[model samples]
Target: MTRIGFRLALAYRSNIIMTCVALVAQVFLLRMIWTSVYGSRPAAAGLTLDALLAYLTLANLQAFVTHTIVSRIIHDRIRTGMVFFDLARPVGYLRQMAGFQAGNTLGGLLLLAPVIPVVLLVGSITVPVNGAGYVITLVLGYVIAVQLALLISLIGFWTMEIGAVSLLYRLVSQFFAGTMVPLAFFPGFLGVVAEILPFKYMGYVPAAVYVGHISDISGPVVVELAWIAGLWGLLVLTWSRAHRRVVIQGG
Candidate 1:
């Protein structure tokens, strides 16, 4: 399944190209916006222009790499009555989805290889303060993202259409996840809200760690692990109920 997903992603040349183009465009556009905001200033919000740009660049790339279509795929399969075949397989359905998403993420990472250099050149992005910490937190962030996506996909079990729900999730997650702006700029209650939410682990935490906004990764890592554990428990319970629903409906 992983290989199949990787091959499918690679085969979709137009998608890869368009995604890269869009990412590049977004990087430059964001640079312009931030430059204007920082006019004649070296830093604001405790982050230098370069560091802030780096954070945005890495956050955008991470968001793109972690993107998942699992919800849409699950919804379509359920609607077409094809999901039961997956349930009957020896392998667990969630495991299979995770494997495919992993492959898809790898494909996205590959697609970003060239684009990364372009953005780095244009943005003068700073190197990660703690390379090892960045790597560890980023991987943890990916795991958290996958689990969150799976939880969303599980909604397909009850809903006939998940498009609206998925869209709402994307919008909310993107905003709170710090893909559009760093949580540092969220302001008062909004900042407090973002800090408490799991969404920050998806984009903000890892990027902040990379750019040195998060000097100590220990706290964020612990929070991420806690969220991962809690989310997994929720996922297990949800999947159990979803499985029973599928069985009853199929009967």
Candidate 2:
């Protein structure tokens, strides 16, 4: 690995540790609240207890997996002009980011997955079964989440202060994406609205899979893929626009 790669890997290790700790704490807290409130209630209007627990776990993981302040990475680079060097590199800008993500994800699985099940076992909650639909939906969720972050990061092309933008992403993601609570809890009309928005694909639709709600997942998948395709187009378009304005240092 290059020096930068090594450095990023070190940072990735720290993220993995912190993420695992956060997941553990949050899961226990959620279990406490859920047990108290869901004593015997259906997971959500009609979801089974087993399904709810699984959804809870998967949703928690999804939150961490997608949890990142991406705008800062690009904003800081832009402000300091370090990204100038990136412009001249042989590899594409987005490819560099994909490398970092690959490393971070690899490091995260070491801690996040191995310890999570053990912690869940303490609650004696039934682990969510990985049905074919559940697995496919969740995999799709991961892809959309990465796209969401990339979309946010690309905003640095036009905005200097991405803090507010990133915060906006988090707010919408937490509430609308079903990370904080399932969309099923929302009013029916509101839930239907959430269903159509691409944001829900970030966490909600996948959690639905964990709960076996994918009687039909085609629509959700189509929506998510459309967002992915659209966002990638936007990212490329922004890059093309920025290429004109960006001051290349070494070129």
Candidate 3:
């Protein structure tokens, strides 16, 4: 299944390239925005300007790396009655979806190689304080992201199409996941709210860990693992219910 997904991802090379370009442009724009905002202040909200850039850069990469194409793919399958074929297959539906996401993430990381240099040159990307922990947290962040996307995709079982809901998911995730602005920038109450939500594990936590904003990694790691377990349970429950209710219409 992973091999199949890898091949499928290879077919989307052009899309990956475009994504890299867009991410690079985003890094550039963010660099400008944050630089202007900092404007000689050494630090704000416990993050130096360099730390902020590192956070944004890593957050964007997390966003891109964890992006799931399965929602669109599954939506089309459902609409065309092809999802039934998947259901009939011997492979576990959840495992197949996860394998595909893993493969796609590998492809995204490959594409990221080019963008990293640009970000490094312009954004002043820095090494994480806890290099090993950062790597681990980074991988966990991508896993959390994939799980979130899968949950959104599974909604297609009821909606039969995810176009509108997918857009809504992206917007909500972007804000709550701290891609728009660091959670540190949020007011006290909102920051607390964000911390409790799983979205923070998707980007903010890992980015903070990378930039040394989070000194003790155990707390965030434990919370993130708990969220991952919670999300997995939700996915299992939702998929079980949706699979039973599925009634392919029109095709």
Candidate 4:
């Protein structure tokens, strides 16, 4: 399944190129904006321009790598009455989705490789202060991302057409996950809100760990794990219940 997913990802050459181009442009423009914002001001919210750049670079990379294609895959299956065939396969639906997401992540990383050097050259990115902690957080972040995406994809079972819900999820995730801006930079109320949300653990915490903004990694990691456990159960339950309500669109 993983091999199949990998091959499918590799097949999308044009999509990968366009995605890389868009991400590069976004990172470049953000660097300019942050640089201008911090001109002659050493730091704001304890983040220097260089650190901010590093954070943004990693956040964007993580966002790209962890972005989900599962919703569309599931949606198409349901639409074409293919999900019934898929559900009957021995592999099981959730694991099948995971394999595909894993493959997509790997393919995205390949697409992301070119942008890393470019971002590094153009912006000052920090090295991880606690190497092991950073790695742990990063791996957990991917797990959290996949789990969240799985939950979203399962919503198609209820909503039938999940495009709007998926879009809403993306926007909410981007904001709360700190992909758009660091949670620390948000207004006081929103900052507090972001802190309480699991989204921050996905992109921001890992990037912050690498850049030395987050020194105590245990708290965030534990919270992220808890979310993963809870979400995993939710996915299983949703899948079971959704199957009961599923209506095959056609033969």
Task: Report the number of the highest-lDDT candidate.
Answer: 1
Off by over 4 Å in 3: 247-251
Cα lDDT tens digits, model 2, 1-251, are: 13344355456676667767777777777767777878867655777666666666667777776665345666788777787777779988877765555555555554566776765664344534546766677667666666667667777766656778888878887778887677877888988888777767767777776566656778777776777788788877877766655645221
The TM-score of predicted model 3 comes to 0.94
Among these predictions, the greatest TM-score belongs to 1
Candidate 2: stretches off by over 4 Å: 1-12, 122-130, 247-251
lDDT of each: 0.85, 0.68, 0.82, 0.82
Q: After superposition, how far is residue 208 of candidate 3 from its true place, in Å?
A: 0.8
How many steric overlaps are in each model, in order?
A: 0, 0, 0, 0
Candidate 3 per-residue lDDT, tens place, 23-118, comes to 888988998999999999999999988899989988887777767787777788888888788888899788888887787677667767777788
Give stretches of model 4 more than 4 Å off.
247-251
lDDT, candidate 1, 1-251, per-residue tens: 78766776788757987988888889889989998999999988898888889999888888887778777778888888888788889999999888888887777677778788987766677677889998888888889889998999898888867899999988888889898799998899999999888888889988988888888999999988998999999999999998898778861
Worst 10 residues of 1 by lDDT: 119-128
Residue-level lDDT tens digits of model 4 in 1-251: 67767777789867988888888788888889988989999999999888888898878877777787877888888777788878889888899989888887787677667777876666566566778888898888788878888888888777778888889998898889898788889998999999887878778998899899999998987888888899889888988887666645332
**TM-score per model over all chains:** 0.96, 0.84, 0.94, 0.94
Per-model C-alpha RMSD = 1.2, 3.1, 1.9, 1.9
| Candidate structures ordered by TM-score, highest first | 1, 4, 3, 2
